[model samples]
Each structure stands twice: as C-alpha cells, then as structure tokens.
Target chain A: MGKNIFRSLLLGLVMVLAIQLVALAADNQFSGVQITVQMQDHSATRAIQKLLPDFEKMTGMKVNLVILPFSAMKEKQLIELASRNATYDVIMLDYRDVAGYGEARWMIDLGQYIKGPLADPNLKLDDFLPTGVQSLTWKNKLYGFPFYIESTMLMYRKDLYDANALKVPENWDELYANALKLNLDTNKDGQVDFYGCTLRGLRAVGYNDYIYNGFLKSFGGSYFDDKWKPIFNNENGMKALETYIKILKDCGPPSVATFGYEEVMQEMMQNKTAQVIDATMLGTWLEDPEKSQVAGKNGYAMVPKGTVQRGNSFFGMGLGIPVFSKNPDAAYKFIEWATSEQVEKSFINEGAFMTRSSVLNTKEFKERWPLFANLIIDSLADANITYTPILPEWREVADFVSIAVSTALIGEKTPKEALDNAAAEVEKVMKKAGYY
Target chain B: MTKTRRDNTPQWILIPTITFILLLTTFPMAYSLYNSVMDTNLLKPYLGSTFIGLGNYFSLLQDGRFWGSVWHTVYITVSTVVIEFLLGLGLALLLNREMAGNRITRTLILIPFMTTPVVIGLIWRFLFNYDLGIINYVFRIFHLPQVLWLSNQSVALKSVVLVDVWQWTPLVALILLAGLQSLPIEPYEASLVDGCTPWQQFRRITLPLLSPSILMVLLIRTMDAIKMYDLIYVLTEGGPGTVTETISYYLYVIGFKLFYTGRAAAGSYILLIIITLISMLFIKLLRGQYQEQP
Candidate 1:
C-alpha cells in the first residue's frame, strides 16, 4: 500500500511540475470579469481569503466573498440553487453536497473545464488527494475540486499514554482497555478529574453522526445493502452502537450526550479529557499553544478499527461554479487559482487544510505540524470513501440515524430499538424517492 | 354633489391595495394548499407535481413521528402557558401593590421578554449545560444531583417549556398589570366600607373585569407558544430521540431538509387548524364574558 501511494505520489509530482511551467505563462483573458463566491466562515476559508488580493492582481478579476456559518451557508446555497439565483458565481462545494447539486444540475460540470485545452494545467488535478477528487465527482463526472480534506483520527494525551506504559490502540478492544485504565481521579478528589474518552453525541448529521460513521464502517455495518435497502439495524450496527455507548457512559464526561465537536475539543484544551477520536482538522486547535492547555503534549494515530479491517472517514470541501453563472470561464479560473499549490503553501501557519500531495510532502509542513502531518497523510492515503456513501439524500438519512444514536445515548431507547426504527424510516424515505 | 364626482377621478385606488394584500397573504396560503394536494417534493424532480389528492394528508396521519411532534407541541404549549399564567398573575398582583422599588421591579420584570428568543436560547443552553453550566455548578456546590437539562429525552421538553415560561411570563404579566391598573376602584372601596376582605373584593370584582385581557393573553400566548421553533431549534434540536421536536420543527425538517414540500404544507395546515381552533375557543369565551356584562 505504501509503495502504491509512493508511485501515485511520484506521478502527481511529475504531472504538476510539467503543468506548473505551462500554467504560469498562460494569458489572463477575462480581466474585467467580476465573480462573487459564497463560502462557510471557517478557519480554512479565512486563510483562503487572505490570498484573494493576489488572485485579483494575477487574473485582473474582481472577487466578492459572502461568508456564513456552516448550516446557514448550506441553507443559503439551497435557497439560491432552488431559485436559480445568479447572485453567486462560485459557491463553496461540500463533497457530500456534490450528488444533490449535480443531480439537480445546479452546478456546471467541471469535467468539461478541468480537462483538455480549456483546463488550466497548473490546476493540478493529480495533486489533490485521491479521495478528495473522487468525492467531488458524481456519476463519473467531476463536479468540483477539493481544496481541503480531512478524515477521522485518534488524538490522545502523549503524557498520559507514556506514564501508563501504553501503546496506541490498533483496534476496539485495546481502545476500550486503555480508556478503562486512563479514567483517572487526581487531586485526591472523589470525582474524576480527567475523563478517558469523549466523543460528540449532539443530535445533528454533521456533528455526532459524522464521527459515528467511522464506528459503523469499522464494525462492518453499511447504511444500505447492494440494492439500496436499509439494513443498518443488523447485528453489526447494534454492536457498533453498543460499544459506542459503553465508552461514553463508562469513561466520558457526564454531559457526553450534550457534547459536540466544539465541546469535546474544549475538554481536551481544558485538560479535562485524555483522548478524543474525531476529524484530523481538530489537530489545528488542540495543538495551538495559545488556546490549548495540552499543546505539544499530544499523540496522533489512525482511528482504531473494529473486528472488520476498514474504518476511517474521508471528506472534503471545494469550490464549484453555479450553473446560472454569467461568467463560467472566469468562475473556473477563480476555482483553479484558489486551489493551486502556491496559494495553499503561502497560508500554512493559520492551519490551512492543504489539498495537494506536494504540500503534504513538504519538509516545512512536517516540521511545523509534527503532531498531525504524518498521521493525516497516512490516513488520507488509505481514506475509505465508501464508509459513508455519497447519496443525494445523505443529509436526511444521516440526520435520522443521528437522532436514533442520540436516543440510545440518552437511555431513551436501546440501540436495537433506535437503529431498527431509523432503518424503517430510512427505507420509507428511499421508497418515496423511487429508489427501491 | 361636489362637481358630480365622476369626471376622471380614478376608481382604481382600491385595486392596488387589494392586490397587495392578496399577494402578501392569500397567495402563499393558496399556493401551499395547492402543493399539499400534489406530490410537490423538490427532491423527486422526476415525479412532477402530480395531483395526489389527500395523499400527503393520509401519509401524515399515518406518520408516527408527526403525531409524536403534535403531542410534544401540545405538551410544551400547555405547560408553558398554564405555568406562565399562574406565575404571571401573581407577579401582576404584586406589582399592582404600592410597594417600595415597585417601579424598578416592574422594569426588571420586562428583561426576559425583551431579549431575543435566539439569544435567550443560547444563554439558557449554557446555563443548563449538564457538566459546566452555572445551574449544575450550583447544584454541585450544594451537594445536589446535577440534572440532565438538554441530554435526557424525558426532561428535555420540560426544559424547553421552562425556558419559554421564563422568557414569556413577563409579557403576560405586563398585559395583566395593564388590566389591573384600569380596574375601577369603586368596587374595592365599596367592599372595604362594607367590611369585605381583600380576597373577597378581588375574587368578585377584579377577576371579572380582567377576563377580557386574560382571554386576550390566552389567545396571543397560545398561538405564539404552539408555533414554538426557535428556542428548541437552538437548544435540543429535537434530540434525545425526537422527544422535543415540535410540530413546527418537524414541518421545517420535512419542508427544508427532507424537501417533502407537499407533506410539509399538509402538516403546516394541520397545525394552522389547531391554532385556529384554540384561538376561536378563547375568543368565544371572551365574547361570552363581555356579553354577560355588557
């Protein structure tokens, strides 16, 4: 697997290097074009914004930015897409949203633009992470290009692990054992000072349910069968949920069910938790010396597995041109420029979520982010996109499952009861959509 | 009579007003009603808006989650309104008294209702956080068990109700206080001259005179409470297994997230009817009280 990754890495480098020279000499054709782009107000997007002036200078095109929080951004995009608004030329593209947008034909098919003579060779498609590129493609046509990608990974306190003479867990059993041993009571207080584990239990598709997908895939449970029938209530799913509940109840914080990504990450920064298994993006916050109490004292590893051999999640966010855009060529130019490797490298200190393999291979990146750079690339190389299938109804399906998982967490329903109910509802949704 | 009034004076003034009103109000209702009878889901673009009369309603009636949300909405509305009425009346009566700092106290009472609902939800969410909230912190300090305010399903709806009550009781109290200030002093003076107790005067005169305002409060609060969405949307997000999902929240999920526009419109009409019936009940009661006295 490592050798294969290396070969692809070499091929991407050669392609990028060959194209870089050709792209730098290309003409700025659409100098007067003004394009507005909408994006989520996230750390990476803020970092990307800093390079907007340079792009403006290089392309001689005016760019407008409309940034909003995640949910609001999605809602706004939906409203605009549904109404066929020409207000935004370029929009932030979530990999999960690719199917919905593509099927709706609300996005311009970038496969046409990203390849052949129309393509900007410096756009460097091969340089983007494999899963990142694949997730943005729908029905064998490329719809967008990911500029940032992250996957689930284990983040733990190195001091605690070393003091206990523990090795990083490779599978579920070892993880559970370590959690048990690390549930510590310090300061001679009867109450536990440091929790052994914490995972989000907030009832939202993108919150707790995001992490839960890793567990589901690890246990050999798929959300659907070969024929698109809901089968997640099977024994494998129940086991996955049962084990999830066991970890949170036994070693997590008392308010684990109220935990979201922000809260779990907060617990780590406050030194109240020993470990968390969440998106690799969390490394940026947890390793920040100004914000974190445990900065530079953390260990990183791949997300532990279950009885099955597969598990970690890979997802991405990118940019795409709206179908109604007046300046499709200019919009594509902006996307290509924004995701280019040079722009990605310039904003590394702000914890830019790099998309290019060349950036990952940089010695500066490795030295600066020693905690997560290596582990992230390793996980990315083997990132399993099939763990969470790209369906047009993903938002709705994942939301239903999230509610069920939350129900089990709060002791309102058993894992079997909740998962079974959710499976039935999801099946109904599929039937209603004529997917049966 | 004044220049015979018919020469070139346009009769089209009412046209613009009528058109504006209909576009603002009637058009959406008509469009949604039309959608409710058809398969208008955006997700299934292939399945065009085919006329499936009563199909959406039939499915909604059979939908277990829809019914659960209806029950949840009723629980939140009834609990918050009832609790707010009782507490609000007590507050109105107290403020009606000639007590020290009464003016300042009255102003302070308005603070909760004056704050935006979203901000209230955010503040209360922090205050009710199970591990780190101020309420739980105080409970820990007092050696009392911490409550699962947002996490536990059985308690979540009640927590939402409590937040609603906290934010709205002041509005109810202020309305009742206005009614109290407007009450005639003659009956109470007459009762005092006749050696009647304060309770007797209040029970006989004050309550009867305040019935209209009380009914008004009931009408407004009930309609507002039934459409409760913002608070729970930010607080529990219909969590701990759909326990706190109100009818409006469920309708939102169907319309926006699921894109089952037909089902959502149908479900919305059902909620509209429920609100209409409850408002009519309050209005009828108010009419009867006025008829008896007038």
Candidate 2:
C-alpha cells in the first residue's frame, strides 16, 4: 500500500509538470500584433504569401499582405509614404526609387537592425550582389534589404538563327543586319510575319526609360555631368537616338512603339518576334514550356555593343520597413525572415530570381536555371546605373526623355530636335530643383 | 417659438448631408488651393515647403508642356463631343421611330456604356494591335491597307477619340430618345397637314424643342471628356510622344509619378477654372434658350 501511494504521487507530479510546459510553449509571443505589407504582384510575393502562415504560427502575429499591380503598387506606396501613414508596415521598393525615398527619410535606416541582435547571422549580407546592395544604399546608408536583382540581356530564337547560319550579334551594326535578314514573311503576305526584334517602347517613365538607358549608356551618352547639368543633347546622345530609331523602325514590329514588357514577352514567346532586348527575368518565362512556344529554341546573350562601349542597365526590387511603421521590430523580423537564405532558396526553387550569390550559385539552382545564372553573372559585371540618374528629380527627367525618344521613334521630330527640346525641359526642372 | 423650432428641423436634417459634402469636396479643394501656393515636392521634403504665392501658377504658364497638354485636352474633348453628339442624335432619331426590334436594339446599345472604361480600353487596344489584331485581319480579308491605329502619331489620338465615342455615344442617344418621346405630336401632325417635308419638320419643330436635351447631353459629356484619364491611361498612356497627353493625365504624371504636389495642384486649379468657365457659358446659353422658347 505504501509503494502504490508513492508511485501514484510521482505520476501525478509528472503529469502536472508536462501540462505546465505545454501551456508555456503555446503562449502567444506577439499576440494581437498585426503588420501590413504592401508589395507588387509578382512571383516572389506569391511565394512569400505561401510561407506567411508559418510566420504567423511561429510569432503569433497576424499579417495583412496587400498585393497590387506594378504601377498601381508604386503609386499607392508613394501616396502612403508621403502622407506619413502608418498603414503599411513593410513596402516593396524598386532600387531605382531608393534615392528618392531615402532622401525624403520615408524609410527607416535599416543598418541598425541589420547589425543588431535581431538580424540572423546566416543572412550573410555580403552574399547579396554588390550592385543590388549599392543601388539600395543612398548617402552611405542602407534603407532596405535586397529582394531580387535584374539586368537587361538579349533573348533570341536559337532555331531561327542557327537555321539561317547567323551568329549572335556582337554590336549594333550586326544586330541591325541580323534583324533585317531574319525578318521573314512566312506566308508571303508582303507583311513580315516574324519581326526581327521587339523592345519596350511604351511612353512611361519606367517602361521606356529602363530599356532606352541601356542603349544610351552603351552609346557613350550620359544623362548629366558631374555637376548635374543635362548633357544628353550632346553628339553621342543624338547618335544613340538615331541608331535606336533606325533599328526599331526598320526591323521591329509595326506597333513596337506601343509595346511594353508584356507585349514584347508575349510576342517572343509566341514565336512572332525573333529577338527581344529586355529584363533578365524574361528568360525564366521564355523557358517555361507552358507559356512559351519557343521554349528550348531560345538563346541568351549579352546586350549588343554600341559604337563607344557595351553596357547593361542594373536594377532590382527590395523590401523596406517604412519610418511610420508602429511595429518596427516585428517588421524587421519579417523582413529578415523573408530575405533569409533558406527562404530565398525556396523562392528560387519556385522560379523567383533572388539577389543572394549563394542562391544563384547553388548547384540545384544553376542546373534548373542555367541560362539565367550564366547571363545574370555575366551581365552584372558590365551593368551600369548611371544612365538613369539616381537623383530625386530623376523621374521627372526620365519623363521628358521618354517623350523625346518616343516622338523621335514615330518620325514626329528629328533626333537632335527632340533631344534638344527634352534637354531644355530637363534644364528647367533642374533649375527649379536648385541643381543649377 | 414652435414655428422657429419647426423651421430649424429641416436644417438639422440637412446638417449631416451638408457636412459630408463639405468634408468630401470642399476640404480637398481648400487643401489643394493651399498646396498650390506652396513649393511642395514630396520626394524632396528635406528642402521643406515655403509659401511661394503664385510661384507654381507662374511656372505653369511658362511651361510649354502644360500648354501642349491643354491643347491636346481641348482637341480630344471637342472631337469626341462633336462626333458623339452627331452620331448619338442620328441614332436617337432612328430609334424613336416604330421598329420591329427596337426593344432589343435599345438594350443591346447599352452594353458598351455598361462595360467599364478600362476593360473597353483593353479590348480596343487588342483589336487595334498592329500585328495580330482581328481588325487588321478583317482589313486584310477585304484587301484594305492596315492602319497603325495606336502607333502612328497622326492616328493615335483619333483612335482614342474613337474609343470614347464607342463607349459614351449610347448614353447620349438614350438621353435624347427620352427627350424625343416627351415631345408633343401636335406640331408634327400640323406640319404633315401643311404638306411639310420630313426635313423641314425636323429642323423647325423637332430641333428647337430638342435643344434643351441636346444642351444637357453636351454639358455632361463635355465635362466628363475634359477630365478623361482612365481610357487614355490604359490605351495609349499619352504616347506617340505626348500626342495624346491630356491635361488630367499630365496632372496625374506630375502629382503621382513625379511627386511634384505643388505644380500638380496649380495645374488642377487651372483646369478647374477652365471647366468652371465652360460650365457657366453652357448654362448661360441654356437659360437663354429656355427664355427664348416660352
């Protein structure tokens, strides 16, 4: 009877202890805490949304993810930030906008959180591409964490080129020649059924200027001098305009002037356009058999060289916690988790291109996206961001440039006339901004 | 005291609605007016804003792009309103007559107006596409030369105007048809007894009586067309080198895209002044027409 009583008492004590431990572990760490994240509708964001349940479970915090179309997202974010609204705790920012956003102090200085105890050491900040990190830094202060880095490259139909015994174009001259030779009228309809190439010609600051700057930089033209004087009206600038118009008008599709990324991508994937010069992210889409008719027949190469140099435009999208966020620490945690190596690896497996070197160089990633891996590294080596000025007034200037280039493309004005007019407008904007 | 209390009841009932309108409309107007006189650029807040009275307005007058956008707006508004009025009036006249399928046709015509402007823009953009558009395919079948509807600068503005006409012409027609139905039959019977031709009856009686409806449709459509943004934004985005950049679209680019709040505010005020003047002119003409009739 004494032994039975002792055993029963010990078992009850052990059960009580076990129940107490379970209650402690299940306790809400961030109960009642909610953070809203504003991001563009992209594959990466979709992947992030899929993993957010895990985040909520771990921290006991709620997340409100607001995804919007690309253009609408930028406008909404700008409005929210400018209004000093704490509505969005986290925001997705294009690297090009960092200068403008950081200068306004709209985003929190993330250096502290990055170096503090909240940061995971495994993130290995140095593993991010230098260009991606550099673009997101303004005045030597990091404002955001890198999401994905992108550069422009040439995407072409390999079967068409190989069957025609054509070598990949090395320079503008060869590009023009190859384009003209490959512009075929398959049904002899007198109209070319296959366009030589399709490039972004939409007259928007982001759509047209992004691709045109690559040509501008490669042609040895600069947007502004060291003192911030507009110099794109110079000889080289005019030459770039002339060459761009000539090639696009002569060899491109009839409606190339209205084509943005979607139109260009669709045309190439449908086997309607023989080549395209666009963002590096397009390679993955082009290789997807479900969306592409020329999947295995596609070839990747560096952007064509110009008279003076060969260059690529570097850009990326990053995530930043807004200065108005009420839950800064929680927001930081989410950013850290979302951009971690393990999460980025999964993102890569789901076909999201990431900025981390480890993600791009991993054996599985390289094998799955070999073309993109090779092209991204090669293009990053020669990519330049100077073409699109990293100034607060850069967007205004780009608007004028987009109009000038588009007008010239449609044969409305001579290249010199259009560029000079745009230069004058840019000068006025700069003068008003006190850049004189 | 009781009579005064009863009078106050209406004011009390109206207070909430009046307050709502003032909050939604007057507050934003006042705020924009204040912002217009300040040098405010959201992206350059470090520079800070200063009361630069009339600075933004002065710069706008000197800005060529501002004037160019104004010209484009006026051009598009005039072309769309004029064409829509003519086609709408013609359709209204035809539909007013006794016809077998009038009911179905009336309902079918409302489809375009029922559709969203952005969706209409997208559908038209695909139809006007140069390479793979069904419109071009039809033209090829007929051996007619394909036109670059959205690419060529000369035709891009016209294409946008065409889209506006397609969507809003039905609304105008319906308004006019209601006006036509309400018109007395005595004048037409008298004209027929006097051996008057159909054209003479339409000009002398029908047109004079229909002037009020015509003016009403004109005022509504003109206002909407002048502030048009969505269709243009989705279709051409003021492309082919600002050939179609309307004033409202320019204001949007300045305010949202460039974050030049001060300049955009000034631009909006200028547009407001223009619209107000146009409305006053139309109302004065409408009042004169009413007085002249009775």
Candidate 3:
C-alpha cells in the first residue's frame, strides 16, 4: 500500500510540470524577438526600465531602451518617423502630438490590437482616465496607450495659509489677493525673502502658453475660431493677458519672467515661495523629503476658477508603436505589459503618476498620495486640451502666443498690443499653411 | 614615368578626401537650397513639393521677427567680440610678463575654453539666476538692490553676452598669447632704446604685430557668435520677449519647432549669405592688413 501511494505522488508531480511547460510556451511565444523602445528621461521611464528585466525573462524577448531628454526625444522620434526608419519599435508620445502623428499616419492604430489576440479581459480600456484615453485617440482611432496624465493645479503652503488665516483661493481675484498678501519679507531684511506665487514665464514657443492658456481660456478667450481666424486679440484675451502679467509682476519673484517648470518647482520646494500654480508633477517632487523642505506642509487645489471657465490644462504622456516598427507584434506585447494594471500599480508605488482610474482609486494609492489623488480626480473634470490646440500648426501658434505673453510680462508691449501682434503673426502662419 | 606616378598617387589620395567632404557638406547644402525654393512642408506633404520661386524669401523679408533676430545677432556678435578681444588682450599682456605661477595661470584660463559650451551655458545660467544666483547674493551682501539679470528685456541680451565673454575670452587670450610669445624681442628693445613709453610701444609695435592674430580670432569668433545656439538655448532660450533671439535660434524655431522646412531653409540661406558676406569683408580687411605689414 505505501509503494503504490509514493508512485501516485511522483505521477502527480510530472503532470503539474508538463502543464507549467505548456503555459510558459504560450507566454513566451515570441521568444528571442528584440524591440527597441525610445522614451523621454523621466521617473516613469526609469521605473519601466527597472521592470524590463522581469519582462524580458517572462516573455524571453529583449528590450533595447533608448532614453533621451524630453525635447531631444521628440526630435529624434520625428526625424526617425519622417525618414521612415524602423529604428524604434516603441515610442513615448505626448498626447498633444497625437494629431500631428495621427494625421501623418506615422503611428499604427492600436484599436484592432485591443480587440484581437493581445486583448485581456482584465485590461479594460474603459479603466483609463477618460481625458487621457481621449487625448491619445484621434478621429475615434486609438493611436497609443496612455501612460500618465498631468494637469495644472494650485499648490500652496498649508502651514502658511493657516497661520495667516487665509482661505484657499476659489477664484482668480482671491488668488491674486492672497499672492499679494503672502508676498512677505520673513527676515525683515527690507527685501521680500519669499515670493507669493510662481508660474512658467519662459519665452520659448508653446512653453509659456502651457501655463498662461489657463488664464486665456478662463477669460473667455479662444486661440482661434472654427474658421481658423485669429481671435486671441479680443477684449477677453487682452484681459487674460493683463491679469496674468499683473499677478506675476506684482506678487511673483523679480525673475519670474525667466522661470520655467524646474525653476518654479525649485522655488516652491525650497520654501522660498508660498504658492505655485503649476503642473501636477510638481506635487510629487515637492512631497519628496529628499528634494523638498516642505514635504507635508502643502495643500493641493484645482486651478482657481477664471471669469468664464476654470480652463485647466490637461496633457498625457503615452506609448505608441510607430508605423515603421519592424516587430509590431512584440512591441505591442511589451506596451500592453508596461501599461497593465499590475505594472501601473507598481509604477505608482515607485512614485509615478497613473492614468488608470482603477489604479488611482486603489486603497493603496489613495493612502500613499492622499492629497494629489483626490485633486487629480477633481481637476480632470474641468481640464481642457483646447488651450493647446490639437493641430500640426499648434506648436507654431503656441510659440507666437508665448512671445506675445512674454513681451507683455517684460513691459515690451501692452497686453492688447502684444496679443494684436501675436494675432497678426498667427494669421500669417495660418495663411502660409493654406488655412484660408 | 616614376615622377608622373608619384604625382598621380597624391591626386588619387586627394580624390577620396574631396569626395567625402563634398558628400557630407555639398549634398546637404544643395538640398537646402533646393528646398528653400520649394514648398517642402513635412506636415503637409500631401500638397507635394511645388516650385515656389522666391516665395519663402519674400515672406522672410516681410517677417518682423526675422529682422528682429538679425538685429539681435548683430548686437550679440559685435558686443561679445569687442569685449572678448579687449579683455583677452589685457589678460594676454599681463600674462606675457614674468610673473609667479604664470604657467598655472595660463592653464587655469584655458579651463573655461575647455569646458563644453552647453555645460558653460548651464553654469552661467545658474550663476546669473535672479533669486538664487551667487551674483545676486554678492549684491545682497553689499545691500544693493537685486538686478533681474535674465528677466529684464534690457538686461537679458547683455547677460548672455557676459556668459559668451566669460567662455570665449580665454580662447581669445590663448590665441593672442601665442602671438605675443612669437613677437620679436628686437623691436621692443629698439623701441626702448628710442625712449618709447610702455603705452606707446604697445600701441605701435604690439598692436600692429597682434593684428593678424586679432583679426583671426575676430573672424573665428564672429562666425561662432552668429551661430550661437547652445548657450542661448540653455541660458535664456531667447526669452524675456525675444531680446536674445539670435538669427540662428530663430531659424531653429522655424525649422524644428514650427516644422516649416521650406521657410527654415530659406532663412538659413539668408543667414548663410550674411555670414559669407561678413567673412569675406573680414578676409579682405585681413589681407589689407597683411599687405600693410613690412
């Protein structure tokens, strides 16, 4: 009886081993395949890199990661796509670039892949943040998988506000009033030691517009009408420009006009500024004890309401397979794995923002970044990409607007004159692009 | 027969180098020239490359930003070159004398020149930062009001020039020092025997002899300054209302950011023409100076 029982146990172990081999074979079907991924140098990409070895081991596929800074990455991707180089199988694409890439047919539509063999019941597209998914979709065709979403929000020093008995700003007027009130010289050195607020003021094309467009949109200003006519020189547009310039000039740092995202975040993190209306990404950096002095002393809010609208700006960084990719199948496999719910949760734990609603709603995430998770959800409702037009000429138009806004900031031109000049230039650009 | 073969061998060796150079430079240049006259909008390629003769040039001529950028380029080039030359000449003269740690000082001066331009730009950007910069900190120590080095439109261009001067002045000094070391001691001795004062000797003997090196340095630096991108790109990015938007930076915006290939090519050709003209004028002046020399 004992010999018969031992023989039965050995047979059971062999059957289990055979089933595991078959499962491994199915998962590693594309073993030995190599795909190159091009991405921007960011914390999210770094997290993906850390997970790549596990992916390689599981799928038996090799991933060659090429990470570059944001601007250089875009330029490289553009050059590669234009040249039809099959150098990169996967690329990190900005949602703002969807229109240009989609219209150019440079990226493959992943809609079919979603419903086909790569589809997993657990990987639901509906689970992603609606704005993020919509941004990556052009003409009802999904061109990429949303990786992370970002929107503008108001971040202020909670300690400072409570100590001063100041209320969280609900509108532009209150924001400006609070900024002026908080612009204090804490050291009493006859100079303002701490600024009240900071925003992006760099004059590069599309840079300043990213932050200032919130003001423009909230003031009932639109970049262009349906006919592509320049409309930013209207009364509302001038008011928006004036308000943006006035606030920065009066309550912001003396060098506010030179501040970009990095500068503003640094200012706030170092506790030199009491408030900042900037990117959601700044919240994560500011909460880190390693980089920030006031890690837990911050309060998050949706961008203050403008006169006519909140005009919050929304953008997403996504992953897309280029049309020129040689290993599209393997590339899709990797993209799916990287954007999977499991990986997204891991990414969040590693301090990356997530685009999936499920991951964001998870008890674990809410407990980790309690302040930002709630603010992100609230801000997404009012966030609009109209501030950044989704067109090929959008970059050029944003540049013109940035120049105008910067000119107003530096007193080179009045808000009205600057907007008028920018409008004329934009019209010229549109005409040249055959937008008649 | 052997002499003829030897001569032919040199030609054969020269052919490969010439071919390589032409392939690298001439092809892109010709393509740019062709593209300048054609509607080659990468975004609107469906429109096809149409021959639009002088259309881009005419548009650029009417472009106020283009003209503004050209003016900025001229201002930056002239100011940087002038300041660098003066400062370099002064340092070169000082170093030319017998002094303690002269070799160490010369090597130290070359450090800025040795550093990458992009790195130099970043370092200077931090140093000139309005709030946290060491410059403003020093000003604060003296109880002086803070100056908006990069934020003020009037001061932004000057701040960029200061960075350029800091980086390239060492190069100019090195070049002028080499020239100073090569100068004949006999002329100085003769000038001293003639009871010439130090200032007089320098203004006459030193300045005349250093003119060739000065002109060479000016020529090289002018070309570089006109095409200055990395410094301005990293430092101010032609910010503070485009006060520092040099021609090259503007062309980069048109090409890469705007993706107006045809317009960018045309703008580049225009810049090329300006650079060629300026270089030719400098060459002519240099030739005249050479001819004036005994």
Q: List, for all models, the DockQ compared with the true complex.
A: 0.47, 0.70, 0.56
> Would you list the C-alpha lDDT of every candidate in the order shown?
0.86, 0.88, 0.87
Steric clash pairs (candidate 2):
none
Error of 3 at A15 (Å): 29
Residue A142 in model 3: lDDT: 95
Looking at candidate 2 chain B, the ten consecutive residues that score lowest on lDDT are B1-10
> How would the candidate models be sorted by TM-score, starting from the highest?
2, 1, 3
**In candidate 3, which residue ranges exceed 4 Å CA deviation?**
A1-27, B1-7
- Whose DockQ is greatest here? 2
User: Candidate 3, DockQ to 2 decimals?
Assistant: 0.56
Q: Candidate 1, after superposition: displacement of residue A354 in Å?
A: 2.0
Residue A29 deviation, candidate 2, in Å? 3.9
Kept native contacts, as fractions per model, are 0.49, 0.90, 0.76
Chain A superposition TM-score, candidate 2: 0.92
lDDT of model 1 at position A109: 88
lDDT of 2 by residue, A304-359 (tens): 99987775777788889999999988898888888888888888766736788888
Please write out the lDDT profile of model 3 over residues A233-288, one tens digit for every residue: 99889888888888888888888888778888999999999998887766889899
Residue range with the least summed lDDT across 10 consecutive positions in model 3 chain B: B1-10
